[model samples]
Target: EEWMALRIGPVVNLPINHLAELSSKLDPDFPVVAVCNSAYRSSLAVGILQRQGFQNVASLAGGSQAWIDAGLPVYGTETQATVSAAPQRHVHLAERISAADLSRLMQDLPGTFDLVDIRPPQAFAEYALPGSRNAEIADLLSNPGYLTGAGPLVIVDRDGSLAMMIAGILSQKTQRPIKALQGGLD
Candidate 1:
């Protein structure tokens, strides 16, 4: 499973090839269902399959997380729902500089902004945007000046969760504006 295998091995060891093989075995004209824990992985897999000529693939939206949320029963480790409240900083800062505006700033300001990738080291190793430096959220929170640049900070992750969390934290800690990538790298 992605949860366990990815933690202890290289990404090349993932079953992406196996999934491709299985997807190939299916009839392109017929419907196919792909699912995973939170739908993130399954959505990515389905997109890959579609790109590889599987026209009838569909990803289960919300995946097993939604299933569990509906009070459905399943055998195995229980899926605990961890809910969090939105941070006010994120709401306020967006008015100052929208994510789209930030992209323009990347071009306009050049070295004005700093890019931070606050994902697990494994995920960071697999895929990272250009000019991004891997910085753990905890470390960044503790050492704010570590990645300081001339202007505001822009943060991203595999999903936008960590980036958003860091943005909120940094915003509360310092007066500098923070923004998380509109959508994650996926």
Candidate 2:
């Protein structure tokens, strides 16, 4: 891919959701190569960054998979992480818990599960479930152990898609049960 072949030295791992908070920290004129497992999301990120006044941002044409396929180097194993093919995995019923079931589970099993609200703090503050705790996706990615030994860690988000993907990524990192809210709280 033309984009991947450019060989940027450092990679800044940014989730699409955290763009607003971190955008101020990024130099708008600096060259940036946004990447994902597939290029679709990264391509969209290019537009978002551009709209936010980023001047030289571009998306990897085929994303990290293509970069890996072409034998390009990936850096910072400790902080920068990637899911090989998370979405393609077969999702089991237990991987997503319904809101109703989650309610009952909390009632019946009390502290058997940890509810993690991945939405932004303002949204979470406005309306979040009784026991859910607010967290950014970056935090969970940086510390997979946070999801460890917490009964089943239940990730809650606005739509659940991001939550589900995060659950998939964290599941690969830890043996703990990671779940997303089914259909989310929408």
Candidate 1 local lDDT, 9-52, one digit each (tens):
12122255577766656567877666667778778888778886
Give the residue spans of candidate 1 off by over 4 A.
Answer: 1-102, 146-149
Candidate 1 has its poorest 10 consecutive residues by lDDT at 5-14
lDDT of 2 at 171: 79
Residue pairs clashing in model 1 are: none
Residue-level lDDT of model 2, residues 9-111, one tens digit each, is 4666677887766777889988988887779888988888888899898898887789878887765334246666546554433398898889998899988
Provide the global lDDT of candidate 1 against the true structure: 0.68
Off by over 4 Å in 2: 1-94
In model 1, the Cα lDDT at residue 129 comes to: 65
